[model samples]
Target: MTTTPARERTRHEIVRQAMGLFQDRGYSAVSLQDIASAAGCSKATVLYHFNGKAAVLAAVLEPAAADLAALVAAADQLSRAAAQEFAIGEFTDLAVRYRGVMDVVQELIPFIQEMPELALLVADGIRLKGFLAGSDDPLEQDLAGFALNGLTAECRHADGRTDEELHRLCEAALNRLFRPS
Candidate 1:
Protein backbone atom coordinates (compact mmCIF):
# COMPACT_ATOMS: atom_id res chain seq x y z
CA MET A 1 0.00 0.00 0.00
CA THR A 2 1.18 3.48 -0.84
CA THR A 3 1.86 5.51 2.28
CA THR A 4 0.34 8.94 2.56
CA PRO A 5 2.74 11.87 2.59
CA ALA A 6 1.58 12.82 6.07
CA ARG A 7 2.07 9.30 7.34
CA GLU A 8 5.57 9.14 5.84
CA ARG A 9 6.41 12.48 7.45
CA THR A 10 5.21 11.29 10.83
CA ARG A 11 7.19 8.06 10.47
CA HIS A 12 10.33 9.97 9.59
CA GLU A 13 9.82 12.30 12.54
CA ILE A 14 9.47 9.37 14.92
CA VAL A 15 12.67 7.78 13.64
CA ARG A 16 14.55 11.06 13.88
CA GLN A 17 13.39 11.71 17.42
CA ALA A 18 14.02 8.14 18.44
CA MET A 19 17.58 8.26 17.07
CA GLY A 20 18.38 11.28 19.27
CA LEU A 21 16.82 9.63 22.29
CA PHE A 22 18.72 6.42 21.70
CA GLN A 23 21.95 8.32 21.18
CA ASP A 24 21.52 10.37 24.35
CA ARG A 25 19.89 7.90 26.75
CA GLY A 26 20.77 4.59 25.02
CA TYR A 27 18.37 1.86 23.83
CA SER A 28 17.32 0.49 27.23
CA ALA A 29 16.81 3.91 28.76
CA VAL A 30 14.53 5.26 25.99
CA SER A 31 10.96 4.02 26.11
CA LEU A 32 8.37 4.20 23.34
CA GLN A 33 6.60 6.89 25.31
CA ASP A 34 9.83 8.83 25.45
CA ILE A 35 10.17 8.63 21.67
CA ALA A 36 6.54 9.67 21.17
CA SER A 37 6.95 12.56 23.57
CA ALA A 38 10.14 13.69 21.87
CA ALA A 39 8.43 13.42 18.48
CA GLY A 40 5.41 15.39 19.70
CA CYS A 41 3.10 12.44 19.32
CA SER A 42 1.31 10.01 21.59
CA LYS A 43 2.54 6.57 22.59
CA ALA A 44 -0.20 5.16 20.35
CA THR A 45 1.27 7.02 17.39
CA VAL A 46 4.66 5.47 18.09
CA LEU A 47 3.13 2.01 18.17
CA TYR A 48 1.27 2.80 14.96
CA HIS A 49 4.57 3.56 13.24
CA PHE A 50 6.66 0.89 14.98
CA ASN A 51 5.90 -2.49 16.51
CA GLY A 52 7.94 -1.42 19.52
CA LYS A 53 11.18 0.22 20.71
CA ALA A 54 13.38 -2.46 19.12
CA ALA A 55 11.81 -1.65 15.78
CA VAL A 56 12.57 2.01 16.39
CA LEU A 57 16.19 1.16 17.21
CA ALA A 58 16.36 -0.90 14.04
CA ALA A 59 15.01 2.02 12.06
CA VAL A 60 17.50 4.40 13.65
CA LEU A 61 20.40 2.10 12.79
CA GLU A 62 19.27 0.96 9.34
CA PRO A 63 20.79 3.74 7.25
CA ALA A 64 24.18 3.46 8.92
CA ALA A 65 24.14 -0.30 8.59
CA ALA A 66 23.30 -0.06 4.90
CA ASP A 67 26.15 2.38 4.35
CA LEU A 68 28.58 0.12 6.16
CA ALA A 69 27.42 -2.87 4.15
CA ALA A 70 27.95 -0.89 0.98
CA LEU A 71 31.41 0.05 2.14
CA VAL A 72 32.27 -3.58 2.78
CA ALA A 73 30.85 -4.64 -0.57
CA ALA A 74 32.89 -2.02 -2.36
CA ALA A 75 36.02 -2.98 -0.53
CA ASP A 76 35.44 -6.65 -1.34
CA GLN A 77 35.70 -5.92 -5.05
CA LEU A 78 39.19 -4.47 -4.72
CA SER A 79 42.56 -6.20 -4.48
CA ARG A 80 43.83 -6.77 -0.97
CA ALA A 81 46.09 -3.70 -0.81
CA ALA A 82 43.52 -1.51 -2.52
CA ALA A 83 40.76 -2.87 -0.34
CA GLN A 84 42.74 -1.96 2.74
CA GLU A 85 43.14 1.64 1.58
CA PHE A 86 39.57 1.93 0.29
CA ALA A 87 38.08 0.43 3.42
CA ILE A 88 40.13 2.66 5.70
CA GLY A 89 39.03 5.88 3.95
CA GLU A 90 35.42 4.83 3.49
CA PHE A 91 35.07 3.43 7.01
CA THR A 92 36.54 6.56 8.53
CA ASP A 93 34.04 8.69 6.62
CA LEU A 94 31.19 6.43 7.71
CA ALA A 95 32.29 6.37 11.33
CA VAL A 96 32.30 10.15 11.44
CA ARG A 97 29.06 10.52 9.50
CA TYR A 98 27.24 8.06 11.70
CA ARG A 99 28.99 8.81 14.97
CA GLY A 100 25.77 9.01 16.98
CA VAL A 101 24.59 5.71 15.58
CA MET A 102 28.05 4.29 16.26
CA ASP A 103 27.72 5.39 19.86
CA VAL A 104 24.32 3.70 20.14
CA VAL A 105 25.64 0.51 18.54
CA GLN A 106 28.57 0.44 20.97
CA GLU A 107 26.07 0.61 23.81
CA LEU A 108 24.17 -2.28 22.27
CA ILE A 109 27.24 -4.54 21.85
CA PRO A 110 26.59 -6.64 24.96
CA PHE A 111 23.23 -7.53 23.48
CA ILE A 112 24.10 -7.40 19.77
CA GLN A 113 24.19 -11.16 19.31
CA GLU A 114 20.56 -11.34 20.45
CA MET A 115 19.39 -8.59 18.07
CA PRO A 116 18.60 -10.21 14.74
CA GLU A 117 18.20 -6.82 13.06
CA LEU A 118 21.85 -6.05 13.80
CA ALA A 119 23.35 -9.30 12.56
CA LEU A 120 24.32 -7.94 9.14
CA LEU A 121 25.96 -4.93 10.81
CA VAL A 122 28.05 -7.21 13.01
CA ALA A 123 29.16 -9.25 10.02
CA ASP A 124 30.05 -6.16 8.06
CA GLY A 125 32.05 -4.90 11.04
CA ILE A 126 34.12 -8.08 11.12
CA ARG A 127 34.79 -7.83 7.41
CA LEU A 128 35.75 -4.18 7.69
CA LYS A 129 38.06 -4.96 10.60
CA GLY A 130 39.84 -7.57 8.51
CA PHE A 131 40.32 -5.04 5.73
CA LEU A 132 41.68 -2.53 8.21
CA ALA A 133 44.22 -4.88 9.71
CA GLY A 134 45.53 -6.61 6.53
CA SER A 135 47.89 -9.02 8.31
CA ASP A 136 48.32 -12.75 7.63
CA ASP A 137 48.66 -13.78 11.28
CA PRO A 138 45.28 -13.96 13.08
CA LEU A 139 46.63 -12.67 16.35
CA GLU A 140 48.38 -9.68 14.80
CA GLN A 141 45.48 -8.80 12.57
CA ASP A 142 42.92 -9.16 15.35
CA LEU A 143 44.86 -6.90 17.67
CA ALA A 144 45.43 -4.30 14.99
CA GLY A 145 41.83 -4.43 13.86
CA PHE A 146 40.44 -4.05 17.36
CA ALA A 147 42.81 -1.17 18.05
CA LEU A 148 41.71 0.63 14.90
CA ASN A 149 38.05 0.06 15.71
CA GLY A 150 38.41 1.10 19.33
CA LEU A 151 40.38 4.27 18.59
CA THR A 152 37.99 5.33 15.83
CA ALA A 153 34.94 4.83 18.08
CA GLU A 154 36.58 6.67 20.94
CA CYS A 155 37.54 9.57 18.68
CA ARG A 156 33.88 10.14 17.84
CA HIS A 157 33.35 11.24 21.42
CA ALA A 158 35.86 14.08 21.11
CA ASP A 159 34.05 17.33 21.80
CA GLY A 160 34.72 20.49 19.76
CA ARG A 161 35.75 18.45 16.71
CA THR A 162 34.11 19.10 13.37
CA ASP A 163 33.15 16.10 11.25
CA GLU A 164 36.16 16.90 9.05
CA GLU A 165 38.36 17.03 12.11
CA LEU A 166 37.02 13.75 13.40
CA HIS A 167 37.51 12.13 10.02
CA ARG A 168 41.10 13.32 9.83
CA LEU A 169 41.89 12.21 13.36
CA CYS A 170 40.30 8.82 12.87
CA GLU A 171 42.05 8.35 9.53
CA ALA A 172 45.38 9.22 11.14
CA ALA A 173 44.84 6.78 13.98
CA LEU A 174 43.76 4.00 11.64
CA ASN A 175 46.78 4.64 9.47
CA ARG A 176 49.03 4.46 12.48
CA LEU A 177 47.48 1.20 13.57
CA PHE A 178 47.78 -0.32 10.10
CA ARG A 179 51.16 1.16 9.27
CA PRO A 180 53.86 -1.30 8.22
CA SER A 181 56.48 -1.93 10.88
Candidate 2:
Protein backbone atom coordinates (compact mmCIF):
# COMPACT_ATOMS: atom_id res chain seq x y z
CA MET A 1 0.00 0.00 0.00
CA THR A 2 1.11 3.55 -0.71
CA THR A 3 1.48 6.22 1.95
CA THR A 4 -0.98 9.10 2.10
CA PRO A 5 0.41 12.63 1.68
CA ALA A 6 0.35 13.21 5.42
CA ARG A 7 2.13 9.94 6.07
CA GLU A 8 4.67 10.62 3.37
CA ARG A 9 5.31 14.05 4.87
CA THR A 10 5.87 12.46 8.23
CA ARG A 11 8.24 9.94 6.68
CA HIS A 12 10.20 12.63 4.87
CA GLU A 13 10.34 14.63 8.09
CA ILE A 14 11.69 11.63 9.95
CA VAL A 15 14.39 10.98 7.38
CA ARG A 16 15.41 14.63 7.18
CA GLN A 17 15.72 14.83 10.93
CA ALA A 18 17.61 11.56 10.95
CA MET A 19 20.08 12.83 8.33
CA GLY A 20 21.19 15.73 10.53
CA LEU A 21 21.45 13.56 13.61
CA PHE A 22 23.32 10.82 11.77
CA GLN A 23 25.67 13.34 10.17
CA ASP A 24 26.49 14.87 13.52
CA ARG A 25 26.68 11.76 15.71
CA GLY A 26 27.25 8.96 13.15
CA TYR A 27 25.38 5.68 12.68
CA SER A 28 26.01 3.81 15.96
CA ALA A 29 25.22 6.62 18.37
CA VAL A 30 21.79 7.72 17.10
CA SER A 31 18.55 6.18 18.39
CA LEU A 32 14.98 6.07 17.10
CA GLN A 33 13.86 8.25 19.99
CA ASP A 34 16.38 10.87 18.96
CA ILE A 35 15.00 11.01 15.41
CA ALA A 36 11.44 11.24 16.68
CA SER A 37 12.31 14.03 19.08
CA ALA A 38 14.18 15.91 16.40
CA ALA A 39 11.22 15.51 14.03
CA GLY A 40 8.77 16.58 16.74
CA CYS A 41 6.99 13.25 16.60
CA SER A 42 6.70 10.14 18.75
CA LYS A 43 9.18 7.29 18.66
CA ALA A 44 6.48 5.07 17.19
CA THR A 45 6.14 7.43 14.29
CA VAL A 46 9.85 7.11 13.62
CA LEU A 47 9.61 3.33 13.75
CA TYR A 48 6.57 3.35 11.49
CA HIS A 49 8.49 5.32 8.89
CA PHE A 50 11.71 3.30 9.06
CA ASN A 51 12.09 -0.29 10.25
CA GLY A 52 15.38 0.45 12.00
CA LYS A 53 18.71 2.25 11.98
CA ALA A 54 19.99 0.54 8.84
CA ALA A 55 17.03 1.81 6.83
CA VAL A 56 17.73 5.32 8.05
CA LEU A 57 21.39 4.93 7.16
CA ALA A 58 20.41 3.84 3.66
CA ALA A 59 18.08 6.81 3.34
CA VAL A 60 20.86 9.16 4.40
CA LEU A 61 23.17 7.69 1.76
CA GLU A 62 20.55 8.09 -0.99
CA PRO A 63 20.70 11.87 -1.21
CA ALA A 64 24.47 11.98 -1.12
CA ALA A 65 24.57 9.49 -3.97
CA ALA A 66 21.97 11.43 -5.92
CA ASP A 67 23.88 14.67 -5.33
CA LEU A 68 27.08 13.10 -6.63
CA ALA A 69 25.28 11.70 -9.68
CA ALA A 70 23.81 15.07 -10.50
CA LEU A 71 27.20 16.70 -10.10
CA VAL A 72 28.82 14.13 -12.36
CA ALA A 73 26.09 14.49 -14.99
CA ALA A 74 26.50 18.26 -14.87
CA ALA A 75 30.19 17.91 -15.55
CA ASP A 76 29.28 16.74 -19.08
CA GLN A 77 28.28 20.37 -19.79
CA LEU A 78 31.74 21.80 -19.17
CA SER A 79 35.07 21.88 -21.03
CA ARG A 80 37.06 18.71 -20.38
CA ALA A 81 39.46 20.49 -18.04
CA ALA A 82 36.60 22.16 -16.20
CA ALA A 83 34.75 18.88 -16.08
CA GLN A 84 37.75 17.22 -14.47
CA GLU A 85 37.82 19.98 -11.88
CA PHE A 86 34.08 19.53 -11.35
CA ALA A 87 34.60 15.83 -10.81
CA ILE A 88 37.25 16.43 -8.16
CA GLY A 89 35.11 19.08 -6.48
CA GLU A 90 32.16 16.73 -6.47
CA PHE A 91 34.33 14.02 -4.99
CA THR A 92 35.61 16.40 -2.31
CA ASP A 93 32.07 17.54 -1.41
CA LEU A 94 30.89 13.96 -0.84
CA ALA A 95 33.90 13.20 1.38
CA VAL A 96 33.23 16.30 3.47
CA ARG A 97 29.49 15.67 3.65
CA TYR A 98 29.76 12.04 4.64
CA ARG A 99 32.80 12.04 6.88
CA GLY A 100 30.59 10.56 9.57
CA VAL A 101 29.48 7.71 7.31
CA MET A 102 32.98 6.75 6.22
CA ASP A 103 33.27 4.12 8.92
CA VAL A 104 29.81 2.82 8.07
CA VAL A 105 30.77 2.34 4.41
CA GLN A 106 33.99 0.69 5.45
CA GLU A 107 32.25 -1.67 7.85
CA LEU A 108 29.56 -2.57 5.35
CA ILE A 109 31.99 -3.23 2.51
CA PRO A 110 32.41 -6.89 3.34
CA PHE A 111 28.80 -7.52 4.31
CA ILE A 112 27.43 -6.03 1.11
CA GLN A 113 28.17 -9.36 -0.50
CA GLU A 114 24.59 -10.35 0.35
CA MET A 115 22.94 -6.91 0.29
CA PRO A 116 22.24 -5.95 -3.32
CA GLU A 117 20.10 -2.86 -2.71
CA LEU A 118 22.61 -1.46 -0.28
CA ALA A 119 25.39 -2.23 -2.72
CA LEU A 120 23.53 -0.56 -5.60
CA LEU A 121 23.63 2.79 -3.82
CA VAL A 122 27.39 2.37 -3.75
CA ALA A 123 27.45 1.20 -7.37
CA ASP A 124 25.94 4.52 -8.43
CA GLY A 125 29.07 6.14 -7.11
CA ILE A 126 31.17 4.09 -9.50
CA ARG A 127 29.72 6.13 -12.33
CA LEU A 128 32.27 8.65 -11.17
CA LYS A 129 34.81 6.48 -12.93
CA GLY A 130 33.60 7.93 -16.21
CA PHE A 131 35.48 11.14 -15.47
CA LEU A 132 38.69 9.54 -16.60
CA ALA A 133 39.85 10.34 -20.13
CA GLY A 134 40.57 6.67 -20.69
CA SER A 135 37.10 5.78 -19.50
CA ASP A 136 36.72 3.51 -22.49
CA ASP A 137 39.10 1.20 -20.70
CA PRO A 138 37.20 -0.40 -17.84
CA LEU A 139 40.39 -1.18 -15.97
CA GLU A 140 41.57 2.40 -16.21
CA GLN A 141 38.22 3.68 -15.07
CA ASP A 142 38.29 1.41 -12.04
CA LEU A 143 41.85 2.44 -11.23
CA ALA A 144 40.94 6.11 -11.57
CA GLY A 145 37.93 5.68 -9.32
CA PHE A 146 40.07 4.03 -6.64
CA ALA A 147 42.68 6.78 -6.92
CA LEU A 148 40.06 9.51 -6.64
CA ASN A 149 38.56 7.77 -3.64
CA GLY A 150 41.99 7.91 -2.02
CA LEU A 151 42.33 11.60 -2.96
CA THR A 152 39.02 12.37 -1.32
CA ALA A 153 40.20 10.64 1.85
CA GLU A 154 43.35 12.71 1.69
CA CYS A 155 41.36 15.89 1.16
CA ARG A 156 39.06 15.00 4.04
CA HIS A 157 41.90 14.37 6.49
CA ALA A 158 44.41 16.89 5.14
CA ASP A 159 45.80 18.63 8.20
CA GLY A 160 46.05 22.36 7.52
CA ARG A 161 46.31 21.93 3.74
CA THR A 162 44.78 24.95 2.06
CA ASP A 163 41.75 24.25 -0.13
CA GLU A 164 43.80 25.28 -3.15
CA GLU A 165 46.56 22.86 -2.21
CA LEU A 166 44.15 20.01 -1.70
CA HIS A 167 42.40 20.74 -4.98
CA ARG A 168 45.77 20.90 -6.73
CA LEU A 169 46.72 17.53 -5.34
CA CYS A 170 43.37 16.10 -6.44
CA GLU A 171 43.78 17.53 -9.92
CA ALA A 172 47.31 16.26 -10.14
CA ALA A 173 46.18 12.81 -9.06
CA LEU A 174 43.50 12.74 -11.71
CA ASN A 175 45.93 14.04 -14.28
CA ARG A 176 48.37 11.32 -13.47
CA LEU A 177 45.63 8.68 -13.62
CA PHE A 178 44.50 9.56 -17.15
CA ARG A 179 47.65 10.94 -18.64
CA PRO A 180 48.59 9.34 -21.96
CA SER A 181 51.28 6.70 -21.65
Report, for every candidate in turn, its global Cα lDDT versus the true structure: 0.83, 0.68
Find the candidate with the highest TM-score and give its number: 1
Q: 1-181 in candidate 2: lDDT tens per residue?
A: 9757998888888888887776567555789889889999999887787777777777766776677768767877887667666776676566555554553464455454455546656655665666654356768767876785576557546677776666667666666666644
TM-score of each: 0.89, 0.60
- What is candidate 1's lDDT per residue for 1-181, written digit by digit as tens? 9767988899999999998988788889999999999999999999998888888888899999899999999988988889888887898888888888878887887788788767888889888888887756798578766765585467547687888888898888777777655
Listed per model in order, the count of residue pairs whose N, CA or C atoms clash below 3 Å is 0, 0
Find the 10 residues in a row with the least total lDDT in model 2: 100-109
Q: Which lDDT value does model 2 have at 35? A: 87
Best by lDDT: 1
Model 2, stretches more than 4 Å misplaced? 1-42, 72-86, 93-107, 112-120, 136-139, 160-165
